[model samples]
Target: MSRPDPVFPFFLDHPARVTSDRLELLTALVNGPRFDPMFRGDLLVVPPDHPVYRWQCRVGGCERPGQHHVELCFQQDREWAEARASGGNQAEFLEAATRRQHAGWSRFPA
Candidate 1:
């Protein structure tokens, strides 16, 4: 007959220890140099203008999350659609686009 796994009993008996160890490992990983500093904090706050991870609407002063594939937020995208239909180019739209207020969520420092 085959013997039972030795690790299962240890984990079952020391769940708190397991949890603490996992947290410790996670903390260490987060504090490590390889991890990006932007995501090291308790609250992840990516900058709107980050070169690699652009998270905000492209329109100036807009505070909405960008839609997938499209850089602009819902309102801006709708506005752009309407403007485009009227023969307005993206450059002109960007120049004349009105500043939008922050989304419902509270603002975090970049």
Candidate 2:
């Protein structure tokens, strides 16, 4: 007898060799839908004149399809620090922290 594949075969930590439809279905099931901030292809990595930014997942480097980076706001700069750190996404601290650099979310590489 033949066996069926798992319903959700993709693991976030590992590379998934899944079809686009499968990935779309999974994303829709979970996050419903998300707007692509990288659509503009600007500041995808960071904003201009940013004091300091650290690239996350350095292991993946620029080669990764989706590069994650976050700005490093020092404690002394309370305004900027609080603004960046205010985001409630505890899962990815750096990811949330970097959001403060842009108006909303812009993927434009800068």
Best by lDDT: 1
Instruction: After superposing candidate 1 on the true structure, give the runs of residues whose Cα lies further than 4 Å from its correct spot.
Output: 1-35
Residue 30: error of model 2 in Å?
A: 13
TM-score of model number 2 = 0.18
Give the poorly placed runs of model 2, Cα more than 4 Å off: 1-18, 26-36, 39-43, 48-110
Summarize candidate 2's per-residue lDDT along 7-44 as a digit string, tens digits: 55554444455566677876666553454433334445
Report, for all candidates in order, the number of backbone clashes: 0, 8
Q: What is the lDDT of residue 55 in candidate 2?
A: 34
lDDT for each residue of candidate 1 in 1-110, tens digit (9 for 90 to 100): 99997776878968779878889999999899998998877787777778889988888888777786878888889999999999999999988988788777725474
**Candidate 2 residue pairs that clash:** 41-108, 41-109, 42-107, 42-108, 42-109, 43-108, 43-109, 44-108
Q: All candidates' TM-scores? A: 0.60, 0.18
* Weakest lDDT window of 10 consecutive positions for candidate 2: 57-66
Question: lDDT scores for all predictions?
Answer: 0.84, 0.39
Q: Choose the strongest candidate by TM-score.
A: 1
